[model samples]
Target chain A: MQWEIVIGLETHVQLSTRSKIFSGASIAFGAEPNTQACEIDVALPGVLPVLNARAVEKAVRFGLAVDATVNRRSVFARKNYFYPDLPKGYQISQYEIPIVERGSLEIVLGERSKTVRLTRAHLEEDAGKSLHEDFHGMSGIDLNRAGTPLLEIVSEPDLRSAAEAVAYGKTLHALVRWLDICDGNMQEGSFRMDANVSVRPAGTTDFGTRCEIKNLNSFRFLERAIEYEARRQIDVLEEGGTIRQETRLYDPQRDETRTMRSKEDAHDYRYFPDPDLLPLEIGADSLHSIAQSMPELPGAMRNRFVATFGLTPYDASLLTTSREFAHYYESACAGLSGTTPKLVANWMTGALAARLNESGCDITQSKVAPEQLRALIGRVADGTLSGAMAREVFEALWAGEGEVDAIIERRGLRQISDSSELDRLTDQVLAQNAAQVADYRAGKAKAFNALVGQVMKVSKGKANPQQVSEILRRKLALPGYFLPGA
Target chain B: MALAIDDVRRVAQLARLRIEDAQAAPMLAELNTILHLIGEMQAVDTSGVEPMSHPRDVAQRLRADEITEPDRRAALLALAPRAEAGLYLVPKVIE
Candidate 1:
């Protein structure tokens, strides 16, 4: 029997504001256990919440970027529950009306793109942490992360496979970083993904029951968890068994999903409007102001790269993964004369990217500046330096030795392209390798490359490779050349 | 709906409150009285009335985005029932 997987993601993105959502405590991570917890965050008596305006601004900016309906007035509600980590005994969140609704993100699958519709994006507060390790059998509660702001984005069940779901997750991550709303860091728990996975028989319309897999923080985990859960559901149905609706946790060590709780044991969160905060309102003037200040979105930038710079679809997508990287690429090629984008992109993605990954530094933190790289690119384009020699000079530039020209001169790595000088070297190379010279005249194409290698090696790699190939073709084909050791 | 004896007992468990059997009947009676009053109010709803979250129509008061609070971990830890190593100690919680 054939089965189809259905997936919808609920992503919790922590906004990058300085303060908590409803308190003035610093939202810095890795402080002392409860140092960042203020009175309101810890739920002290007589303490009331004061909504952070900056968090609301972030949501509005995201809404504008996605072309969503930014609700002018939205209410905050208390999701009542009891847990040790929940200091307030209830989480202040949005229930009936969310801040942003009906947004869509574009995901590229293979060579085609599709739009994933969002149900809503709501503003909520993060709970504290419960530390069970090193407790001597007693758990400890750290309220430092309490009251941190989160924008919960729920998507429509439009995805059909694990690959599609992860692609959607990646696109969303890039969009959040592009909008400057979230840092999109999974290790720090800033951006987390939860997937609702179910399987139904192919060519059927009725929906099957779904069990949610919780807190998949990385893209690999997201894909693996969805694939495991969908297969689990299909196996149960194929064996004439029923799948229980529940919440499951993915064990990275085991690479399997385990049942955390049954649906019958789900908490009944008696939700009601939070009376402390009034309904949030965004004025039309403010919406217009934010819309005017919006940066070029990733989708727009990717299309422009393809159209303007003639980049491949894959290269354009990769270059626009982050705003900082995209800006670096633009600056490296910006206002440079006589250079093609193909050359600039090849260097950025190949050489510079490899170096950055090796040093564990971001492109923004690179020692080689944009204009410095542009100068390196310029020399390579005009044949002032061989590709091999250019790489040596680039290392010098990255190490802060000197400018491109100075580094090239200091290392004596300039390409030798004088035709008279290359003619003398070519004569010595063809005489030494009579086999390759005879083979070249006998129409063996690869023999010509062996002759060029000899000329470059004899010149100590100072000879221009193009000039060696060109001069070798002229000397080996003099009309009366004799073949030896053929 | 009115609260029965069992309903009140379950609510007590969820709230982590321990009520003796002797107090269960009176607790049920008092909670039912409050519910009966709430039921009476629910009977009369003017269809056009907007649900009010607060008694007065006022905007929420917002605070500036500046750090005005200092780290008072030692002072606050002094008020905990049991604390060690800058953490609030509680019973070991398992999900």
Candidate 2:
């Protein structure tokens, strides 16, 4: 029997704000344990929480970017829980009224596009960190991150496989960074995801037992965690064991998930509207202003690349996947007359990407200037240099050398387009391989490829391969003195 | 809306509490009382009402892509029960 894997993701993006959500304390990571914590963050007596205006603005921007409904009024509730990391004893979050509702994200899965519906995105304060090490059998709490603002984006269970989940996560990652709302840095815990995975029989109406996998910080880990959990659940059900609804932690080292606890319902948190803060209210003018300020998102950018630049859907998708990469590509293509975008994309994807990967640098930090890259592409288009020679010039430019013209002149790497020179090289190749020439005359057509290889080698790979192939075919069709079968 | 004895025990275990089995009966009654009050929120119709995620309506206030140092090293260390060489020391589990 076929099994269907159903997955949803809850992504927590820490807003890149200068201060805490409800307090003026600096929202800086890696601060000493409790130094950044103020009385409000620690939930002291008689301390009332003040909402941060910048944090709310960030949430509004995300809502506008996704074309979701931004509520004019919302309320913060105290999620009552007991933990060492939570200094406030209860976390202030939205339980009933969320900020953004019914947003959709478009993700490309293989050759087809699918839309993943967002259930809601709400703003909440992050809990503090717990240090289990260093203390003698006692855990310590660091409140530096206690009041940091987080935007929890929840998606509906529209994803059907692990690959789709990864695609959704990556698209969300790109969207957040492009909007400049969050840093989307997985390594620094700026962006993280918790995957809720369940499986049932294909086409079944009933849902299977769901498991929440926590703390997946990278796309690779998100895919692996979901895949492993799906298999584990399927095996358990097949073996006549009941699937328990639980929260599990993904162990990246083991590449597996372990049960953390059984899932909790909303009633378990004992939620109530927080009296320390006032109800949030916004006017229409503010929402309109935010919507106007929204930049070109990844979807719009991809379509523009395809339409204006004449790039294929796949090439456009790759170029616009990251904001930095897209900016670099457009800057490189600027002011280059008669250079097709397809050509520029080829060079960027082929030589530039390889160099960036080798140097462990991003597109912004690359040594090759956008203008110099354009010049190299111009050389290829004008036939002054072959594609093979352009690669060599690109390598030199990536190594912080001189410009394209200087590199070509210094290395004598100009293409051999002169027919006289090419003809001499071709004849020399045919004479040297007399046996192959005889075989060709005897109708062994495959033997003619040896002559083309010889001609390219003689020219030191500077010869235009297309021209060489054309001249070889012309010569091979002529009546030869060594025509044996004829 | 009150919690049952088994519900209290289950929630306690989910929270990683080492509660005694004998205390389950009393904790269940207390949890039930809390739930009964919270159940009042369900009476209000939330249809077509948008949920609130944050307090403000502003969007897209990004920090400059520059590094800012967080200068609370001393205060953070003060919360550690044990610290040496700017590192928190934990019990050794492996040799």
Candidate 3:
């Protein structure tokens, strides 16, 4: 019997607030251990926790982006546990009700888009890091990350395959960055994921026991861990064994998972409302302002591109993946209305992307401003320059040589579109190449192309190929050729 | 409504604390006193009163999102009993 994989993700997005969640300490990564950790972050006595309004605004911004209902009021609770990294002996987090509730995101893989339901996104404080290396039989604590604000986004068990999980991850990564809430930097542990994976027999509605795979720091690990855990569960179930619910760690070196601990069912985290913080209540004015301040979401922008700009859904999605690129494209397309948007989209995704990669810079850092690119696109859109020549002008602009019109004029690369001038060039080529013209009359398409090339060469490659081909064909069929209609 | 002595010992174990046998009864009694007072308050008919998470009328005193602390690693780590390489060392903990 086939097995179905059920996967859910709990992603911790470290909000990019300038300070710690409840303290005025820096959360900058790569700081020395305990250097940025203030007294409150270190859990000193008599130090009380306070909320950061910027962190709250970021959470609200994310909620609006996902179309989730932003709970006007939410409560902070203490999650009690005994870990060396947790100096306070309990983590301040939301329990009974989260700030954001019941949102869904559309994850598109190629042409198929799937919607994943989110259970909730709660606000919480991060714990410090435990350093085991070079400690000689002891572990060290780096409280730099302690008390950092994190928005723990939990998704429903809706993903079916490893590929879908990865796509969803990438989409979520882009969305957070687009919202400017989280930097979505995986290398710095700013964004982390824990996947719960299980496998049940196909066509069954009953759920199977899931093992939580913790701390997948990278997207590749997220995909591999979920895949490996699913297969492992299926193997055990097939061998007449029951799957045990436990927490496992993904060892990337071996590409396998081992039991971290055989969890004794549930650790009753005695949760109670944190008496230090009052209930967080948002007003309608706050919600309205946040909603009004939100930039156009990717989905809305994608539809607008398709409807207004006449772009394919594929091109629209690609351009709107990042806010910077989307803004760049819009700025380039500004004031150039009724022009072919696909021209801009094609160059942005195709030639411009290749150039940006070659220069090893992002769109923001690239010297090629949107206006410069727009000028180049305009040359190609009209009959001023050929596509290949337009590329050369782009390179010149990238090298800070000159503007588009000046480069075209200085290099003498303008297309010869005057029919009368192209007619003279075409007639001169036909008269000089009588044998090839006879071959063209003999129904040789190659000879016809040769005549067009000859015209272009005779005009010193200034004549437009389309115009030359048209005038050449019209001239050949007039009366001096072998046959007009035969 | 009284807390048992065993309950106190269980909580102590969960908290990674080793309470002496003589201390367990007093801790249990102390916890029971608080519970008894709560039980007495539960008898009062204050159905319309809204539960407050904090006694203060304010939600939370929010601080500006700016880093105001400087590095005090050497001084703070000196407070710990063990230290190495700018890290506060503790007993080896794998889990």
lDDT of 3 by residue, A1-486 (tens): 899999999999999999999988898889778888888887878998878989999999999999898998888999998888899999999998789998999887777778999999999999998987768789999999999999999999999999989988888888999999998889999889999899988999878998999999899999999888988998899999998889999999999998986667346688989987888888899889988999989988887987888888778878888999999989888877675577889989998899888888778987889998888888877889877788888888888987899999999989889888887777677778888878888789899988888887887777888888878888788776634223
Candidate 1 C-alpha lDDT tens digits along B31-63: 999999989999997699987766657766566
The prediction achieving the highest DockQ against the true structure is 3
Error of 3 at A79 (Å): 1.5
Cα DockQ of the candidate 1 complex? 0.58
Model 3 residue B68 CA deviation (Å) reads 3.5
TM-score of each predicted structure versus truth: 0.89, 0.86, 0.85
- DockQ of every model listed? 0.58, 0.13, 0.61
TM-score of chain A of 3: 0.87
TM-score of 3: 0.85
Off by over 4 Å in 2: A264-267, A335-339, A481-486, B1-95
TM-score of chain B of each: 0.84, 0.55, 0.78
DockQ ranking of the models: 3, 1, 2
Which ranges in model 1 have alpha carbons more than 4 Å from their true place? Answer: A134-136, A202-206, A337-339, A441-443, A471-479, B1-55
True contacts kept of each: 0.64, 0.05, 0.80
The alpha-carbon deviation from the true structure for residue A391 of candidate 3, after best TM-score superposition, in angstroms, is 1.9
lDDT for each residue of candidate 2 in A358-400, tens digit (9 for 90 to 100) = 8899899989988888889888887789877888898898887
Two-chain DockQ for model 3: 0.61
What lDDT does model 1 reach? 0.88
